[model samples]
Target: MQSLVIPLLPELPGLVHASASGTVWAITATLLASAVATPVAGRLGDMYGKRRMLLASLGLLVVGSAVAGLSTTLIPLVVGRTLQGLSAGVIPLGISIMRDELPPERLGSATATMSSSLGVGGAVGLPTAALIADHASWHLLFWISAGLGVLATALVLRLVPESQARTGGRVDLVGAAGLSTVLVCLLLAISQGADWGWASGRTLGLSVVGVAVLVAWGRWELRARQPLVDLRTSARRQVLVTNLASVMFGVATMPVRLVQPQVLQLPTATGYGLGKSLLVTGLVLTPTGLVMMAVSPLSARISAARGPKTTLMAGAVVIAAGYGLGVGLMSAIWQLMMVTTVIGAGIGLAYGAMPALIMAAVPISETGAANSLNSLMRTVGAAIASAVGGAVLAGITITVAGATVPGQNGLRVAMVIGGAAALLALAITTFVPRRRPPASADA
Candidate 1:
């Protein structure tokens, strides 16, 4: 829904005119809110109850969707979108819940599927959003989101059991406040840097503040009795290396999402463009999401047979191969689909392995916070990719019909960069400690 807002400009003239930044806020607001809410929700889930926090996240989604569906103005829409973003913790929370509730034998596949849900939702949701926006009223998108949220909430209530594992510590208010401050500043700078000018005072100011606050936040976390994150556990060699590789993986995987649509939708008059309609572009991309789902179990099987470290390295290599293919294969729609599916499979494998790797290093009580932090690392990586990739695309542009469009070489550069990131991830994963025994039942 957030990314969908960009193309929604024509359909939402009234709301756009009402706000200075227009529907762009509808997109950025969600990103910002998701970044902030995810980690906090994880910590809260660890302290109180995963099920309770999960339910609350779902409820926010339900309410947010309904509010956005009914809104006729920009303010209400942004408010609703922000609320929806608050529910971004659902993925990590679900993973943590699975860790607590599932037996070790079943854990690999279940967590893999749960973790892949994040990518699957975005991959599948984009085309669905575009299809609805084209054929039906834009308002219907949120209504459908609301309906799904309600159904998910009910299903979870009926089927999922609350875990007894609890990190019995007082909420670290100062740490939470500091962390939120850091994230908001950093993300705002990255997300808006293009528009504001990367060198502009606002962007530079936020960047500096974010770094300073992050340092302070780290200091506070190390000292707090019950920190928002278990810094020591997170600092473990296994956990630390997994997270570093995840950041690279995040950068490696994001180019498909950022590059494919633009290339597919550009006018064929450009010679290199496919000139597909939004729905068709979406359809071409749909296989990527399906491949992720299809590959999840196989990925889990690989992790079980070898180890998640092996799985992670394999996934990174596959992603690099996919990007290498993309550099040459993007001239045709079918070719692009193949490239995306290949990359998606890699992402599915890597994402599926991440939760297993993290859980194996942290205590059960720390699952929520640990998993959340890992998720946050991926978010940071993706944001950096967006910032850096956008700059690359913007750097080499040709004016088409008086509008700026990225030159073909720009897309190629993105592919090469993505491939490099994946290879870097692969290199980093090579150093991660070999498979340890599954985390102790009582740890």
Candidate 2:
């Protein structure tokens, strides 16, 4: 959505860099709150009530959307986004609720179906937002988001059943604090690296501090009765390798986010860019997500047939091929859409496999925490992509307004890097076993 209206940032009144920085800040706040909220909600659901938290979260999202739509300043917009970030937690909590309430055969599919909402949200958010922003007003985007949130809340309250998965573990506040610090530090480093230079003191200090905090948090979780994340159980070969592969896939395949905006945003002078409006760009990308949604069920089928490891490897290979094909196919906008669809298919396949791999490794009780960490890896990978991709873009200027002209050299570099990273992921995933051996908790 931000990408759609990115060129209009300079046009928003009294908002500093509304399209780029303001929107980035909005999503940054959303994702940061989500990083914490998802795990917290999952754990809380296991304790008090999942439905209670889920409904309450939906309320928060409504408030967030209204607040964002009404906001006149950047900071408040970010705060509003922070409130809406609870969407991240809702699905996880829903999964936990279903596991406790539903029968065994239905649990996995239900969890997967609910989790696919992420893709749905992304697919819907962008183009819808662009259309509203272009024709109706940018505020309408949040209004729609809030309205949908309200509807979902009502439906959940009315139809979705609650769970009684009671547990006695207390909130590990200190551990959560440590991990949040680590996330903040690492994310900040990635966000600021291109702008501040990788060698800068703030980057170096924060990176070191992040690592130190994570180390301390690991030790603490090992000893704590109520751990935020149990590293020991998470380190088993199946879980560990799955998590590692997720991080790689996350980092490797995110070039779409980087590529889509540049491809659409580039001026007409560039031979590559179609120079279509933001809405057109979003429309093109939207189908990729739709394709992802459709492929998710197929992905589940693949996981069932080929095993999660094979599905993962196949996803990686396909992703690499998608990127490779993209290199030769970027001459036109439709070609961009086709390549993205391929990439999205790969994502759907891998995402479907991730949970299966996780379940195969850990005790049922620890699934939420393990998956939360897996989610964290993805967020970290995306942050890195954002930083690196931004740097690549910033390095080469097309000079449309200046005397000296340049081509779309920077964007091409970034896209090729995306392909190369996918290749790297394919290589790594190949070593993952098919129907890998079960892992002991301590292993």
Candidate 3:
């Protein structure tokens, strides 16, 4: 769902009969909705039932996709995209459900696979959406998403068991509202700062208000009887460091998504550009998702034998190496593919380790909210990366046949930043406390 509309972005204004600026809301709406909804959905999942919330989320996806598929105007499309974003909590909820349903021996691999699905969907969605947009009416993109949503909903209803674990409590409406406001204010600013101007009052105002609300929200969460998020638990060494590293990993993983396509598709007249079609670009990047899936079992095994901390550190190192190689590898499609695949493997490893670390630190009852918070951290990191990468690319540009585009140096700088972020994650991961056996278990 994340990558579904990306390939079609250039044509969105015409398709929706709206200005480019207005149509941008379609993407922004999704980001805002996902940011606000993910944590709330997780909390609700823990309170109600993971399967029930998962079903509800999938239902939204189905309805949202259908709405988007049928839409011809901007408002309805934005609404549909927002609804699709509301389903972002499904991943963490799925991981939590696995904790409840799967045996300890199988849990690591199961969660790893579930976690890696995030990348897989994005990696695969690009080519699929690009192919659909090229050959068929673009509405088919949403229709197909709707169909897949329906199929997934049915399968989950029929096959997945409801989790027995529950954190029975009233919804913390105040906390939810506070967090939502903070996220909207901050994410909106970050996402739009480039268009709006970083120094613009709107951007600075939102950033200030977000931080202020966050401080108040933290205090409220610390006091609330049935808090939306357990700040105390989140403050634990393992969970805290894991989430911090998750943010850096989020930052680390985005450059490939942001820079590689442009590098691939920009006109070869620019000398450094590969000048590939969207279809070819998507195919070249597809190996990243494949490699991520392929690495899940290895990640899980490393986590099992050593610790999630070790796996996370190893993943960070691998990601840094990938980006370092990417700095000089942009001239050839094969080189870019190899770089992305390596980064994907690292992301798969890190992503899989995150849930394990969070679940291990928090009570099973808190898994949904905890995992969701971790997921939110990653989203925040990605937003930061997007903002930073956009600024860099926009700042350093070269005109190719009268059209301004990011220069090769800008792309290389972005890759370098990504590598730095990965190393920062590695440094953060070093602080994650090593796992110890349960007191009741024998050494």
User: Best lDDT goes to which candidate?
Assistant: 3
Candidate 1 residue runs with Cα over 4 Å from true position = 1-10, 13-15, 18-20, 441-443
Residue-wise lDDT of candidate 3 within 232-341, one digit each (tens)? 98998888989999999989989888899999999999999988999999999898888888899999999999999999999999999999999988899889989999
Residue 87 CA error for candidate 3 (Å)? Answer: 0.4
Each prediction's whole-model lDDT (CA): 0.88, 0.71, 0.92
- For residue 171, model 2's alpha carbon misses the true position, in angstroms, by 0.5
Model 3 poorest ten-residue lDDT run? 434-443
lDDT of 2 by residue, 1-443 (tens): 22323433545544534555445666567767776676666666655677887888788889988988898777777788788876567766666566557775565556555655556667666777667766876777778878888899989978988664455568889987887788878887888777668999999999999999989988998999877777777777777777777777777656777777677767667666667876787777876667767777777677766777777777787777787777677778778888888887877777766776776676545555666667667666767777887787777766665533224677667777777766676676665566754444334
Q: Return the TM-score for candidate 1, rounded to 2 decimals.
A: 0.97
Clashing pairs in 3: none
Give the Å shift of residue 38 in candidate 1: 1.1
Ranking by lDDT: 3, 1, 2
Off by over 4 Å in 2: 1-10, 13-23, 101-104, 403-407, 430-433, 436-443
**Residue 124 C-alpha lDDT in model 1:** 79
Q: Which ranking of candidates, highest TM-score first?
A: 3, 1, 2
TM-score, each model?
Answer: 0.97, 0.90, 0.98
* Evaluation by lDDT, superior candidate among 2 and 3: 3
